[model samples]
Target: MSDNSRLLRRLFDERVRDLGLTAAQARLLLSLDHFPDQNQCFHADRLEIEPITLTRIADRMEEAGWLERRSDPADRRARILHLTGKSRDIVDKLQSTVEHLFEDTLRGLSATERDTLGKLLDRIGENLARAREQEPVHG
Candidate 1:
């Protein structure tokens, strides 16, 4: 599964190379699209990334005009994320590129096989989630 994920990410990175976004950056943009107006901390938690890392990515994207950071009205110390028109314009293309990649990746798989694979992957994800939940938290 890990190998497959790496391959898929590689393919995605290749496809979006002309768009000037790394796979991780594209994913961050997509996630922010879904949950707009959330602060950097919110995005870092959602992406399971270090806050400083997300902040750096946000900084680059902001400079590129792909996104903007706005002061949160409720929390002056917090900055909310918002996608810019530049990113919005390319989102559909990005999504289509991923869809095409999936189609190519699963070209030989039958519907039943795809369904089984999806179910198995879901179960594995749930198992991992459970294991993580059982781990002790460190400050």
Candidate 2:
């Protein structure tokens, strides 16, 4: 892994460890928690992960009382992920850490610079997604 990636991963993991969750657990909850006006409806297939892996992660979170899974109203076969009350509480706390981290990580950047950095990161994610979609699956 790149030095910056490894550094950020450890920084994030250490900051949120008190929530009694792993890095992956925090990610799943944070993703769902981020859906403010989107009805908390996320298509599991939209994530870059394999469908089976996503399903397993969702199942694990559900078992951990972090979330609940239900069939999507529009798509009976597709599962919709929702944060449970327990998770909602933790998510609020987690969001605080996320927000603080954002501010701290960019402490050296001005507002405009922070905005530019965010835009660049978004573009990188877009490029990565496009690349993944074009890649062939290997067994």
Candidate 2 per-residue C-alpha lDDT over 1-139 given as tens digits, one digit per residue, 9 for 90 to 100: 3797888878889988876777767877787876621222353434455667767887888887878877667767766788888887888888898898878778989989989988999999999989999999999
Give candidate 2's error at residue 36 in angstroms: 7.3
Worst 10 residues of 1 by lDDT: 18-27
What are the per-residue Cα lDDT tens digits for candidate 1 across 1-139?
7899889988888988877788768888888878888999999998889999999999998999999999999999999999998888788888788789989999999999999988998999999999999999999
How far residue 22's Cα lies from its native spot in candidate 2, in Å, is 0.8
Q: Which ten residues in a row have the lowest lDDT in candidate 2?
A: 36-45
Q: lDDT value for candidate 1?
A: 0.89
For model 1, give the RMSD to the true fold: 1.9
On lDDT, the candidate that comes out on top is 1
What is candidate 1's TM-score against the reference? 0.87
